[model samples]
Target: MNSTSKGDRLEDAFYHYLLDQQDRGELIFGAYPPENCRIYRKKAYYCREREADVEFDVVLELYRKGRDTPHLYVIFECKNHEASISEVYVNDFSSKIGRIFPHAVKGVMVVTSRLQAGAEKVARNARMGIVKYDEQGLEIIADRRGSCFEHSFVRSQIFRSANSAKSLKFSAYHDGEYFSSIDRFLGSLEPELVDGIRPENGGGSLPVPYLSIEQIKAAAGKILKFADYESGAVDLVKVCQSLSIDLQFADRAVLDADGVAILGSANFGRKAIEINSHSRETRERFTIAHEIGHFCLNHERYLRSETIIERDLFVTREKDGSFNYERLEYQANAFSAELLLPDAVFLKKTAHFRRDLEMRDRGHGYIFVDDQPGNSATYDELLSRLSTHFEVSKQAIEVKLKKSKMLTDQRKRNEASPISRVFAGLISSRKS
Candidate 1:
């Protein structure tokens, strides 16, 4: 049995579990809890089209001042712990849903338990799905179901991750029903997936624009216009120091928390990055590194952009899915990507990227790197070199080649040129 002293320990445990899962995948994230959106549970409002009188538990308003307001959706409902049905509950919630979700293609349900067989029949009559806790963890997610806390967090992330959609809207959260500056991020449920990370051309079989992530980073750096690539992050820190005159660099924050960096003289003097106690070691470090990238690559863009206000860097979020998807937030993400993995750095070492793959451990996925230039020219040598260096399956190297644009279509299809289909098939079979 779970300890109930806190706000549902089992539910809280699941929240932690969700964090763990996000780390293993590619979800840029943030956390929004139930208390923040509590008001959304009890706000009085007229029905859509003024057809009836009703109040909303969660009212997701669409983006205001945005041309794309149609993209966002809102929902609200009560959560229960019981498995029994209540028609009164449905009648009230259904009315609210019809109002706020005027054209809502998606929905948010704050409900009690996952369905019981009898409850399912009742739910069908409501023309919607009920979000309930699954004790057995065997539920299919046709509807995006989560606990009050979990649902809020996911919706916040989803809206945040919409990336300049201008679909940012207001809702609930642990903090309250306010606007979140950075939109919510798309969430994932994996913790250790190792695919679709690097482009393939660097491995030397294709026309990948560059050799590696470093190269990609470098190219992006020029595109972003850094003062000097040689200075790299050191130059970036200096810039941050200068920006601190008008900025605030956060010394610490929980992972994916609503964060801001203060160039506060006192805060800067403390060297926020050096403070370990207040932030998540891994996430904070990663975020700092990412911010440094932005500093190096995007400062000019931000300074020159007319839409961003001096104090606009900070936005707010309610507990559930409430945020703004336009402007600076996504810009920061692009900055982080370009700074951390510049294109030139990766391009310079493109021929040798396969050599790094030798370090991959089995069950961890495959990697390949080559050393000898003479041997690097041949596909077999390159593949062998990558296998030894990265410890990845040869098939992975092939995909990497495809991503890089190194292999020719004929080689992949025909059985005659430098590589044969039959031969490729044979090599693919020996992945073990």
Candidate 2:
């Protein structure tokens, strides 16, 4: 599409996003109720200094009850650019909003990409908020009545400055503070709202204890027994039903995420899991099982909001090869692996497939994987059979095998050469 079309699309998306928040009673601006909040697109305001009407991409007007005039005005300047937005855009937006509405007005510069060097400083100096809004990143994984976990998560990601705009679902920055969603940004504008908002259960600041493989297996065993599951593949749908958790699917971009687990709480009565619709049935099944794992492990105590499980969350190691036991994501992943592939059933299936494929080696104690000029085909066949039987991804099956110590990966060993090990040690030392 053309640049103008793209810009317009972004404006529309943002406008609707605000409208949705307003409808949900989340767009709080200085105690203004949802009915008193007015959102407009392509709104024009008269500028006395310029003696002409200045147009805005999107506008939010908050009025008191029974009053016609709005007490607060929020102007959004949308910039949909392929490159990073420069300080010039922020300066221009600040100038226009300053000239048009001098009092009780807030201006926000929203872009599709990151800000150029010095752009954020210019925005902060001008007392204007900056929002990096990628349409693909607008998916909602989790939310709570008054939780700040999402805000904390977004702030951590923003401070890292490692993830691109597409990697973040939503982020807002104002006066050195980061917000996770637009509603939170709006609420921050008012001191009263800021004081009123409290983090639910300390806002996911507590560390999750590391769960051993045996503990995860026990949890999965109870779930399987509860579902009366004695089958090849664990039926996630039946399991969710038995637990009274709702399962849903949505057609979203793959970059958005794999799935989200919304845990039941006093504020939010029902538990639900939303999986991104995908063509790969195995992938979808794995996502479902992963969310179910969260529920079975009672992660709601730590995760107070909706927990978005991305592909990267499945990784349990840091770059230096240290385990991240503080994150519930690792625990959930372990539970998912056990729930999908039970020990007894998985071991029996693996042995049967290995025998059927004649993967036995007198010299090696375990099956070798990705070994060239050897039994690579046999290992692949074993993975395929196990993956098919469990209705999970081959990668998942491979991880399970390594965890079970039933296979040896040559590729992993090759990657961990002497030089790499030295570098990894140096990196770990530096971190320490």
Best by lDDT: 2
Please provide TM-scores, in order, for all candidate models, with all chains considered together.
Answer: 0.27, 0.71
Give the range of the ten consecutive residues with the poorest summed lDDT in model 1. 138-147
Q: Candidate 2: global Cα-lDDT?
A: 0.65
Q: What is the per-residue lDDT of model 2 for residues 76-188, given as tens digits with 9 covering 90 to 100?
A: 99988766678888888888898888799989887766676678778878878777665444233234344323344554433325532223445777766666656667776
Which window of ten consecutive residues has the lowest lDDT sum in model 2? 258-267
- lDDT for every model? 0.33, 0.65
Task: Name the best candidate (by TM-score).
Answer: 2
**Which regions of candidate 1 deviate over 4 angstroms?**
1-54, 58-75, 78-92, 95-125, 129-215, 219-235, 240-247, 251-286, 292-432
Predicted candidate 1 versus true structure: per-residue lDDT over 202-300, tens digit per residue = 121111011233433464556435344452232445444544522334443221112222211112222232222323232332344444433343333
Model 2 clash pairs? 142-306
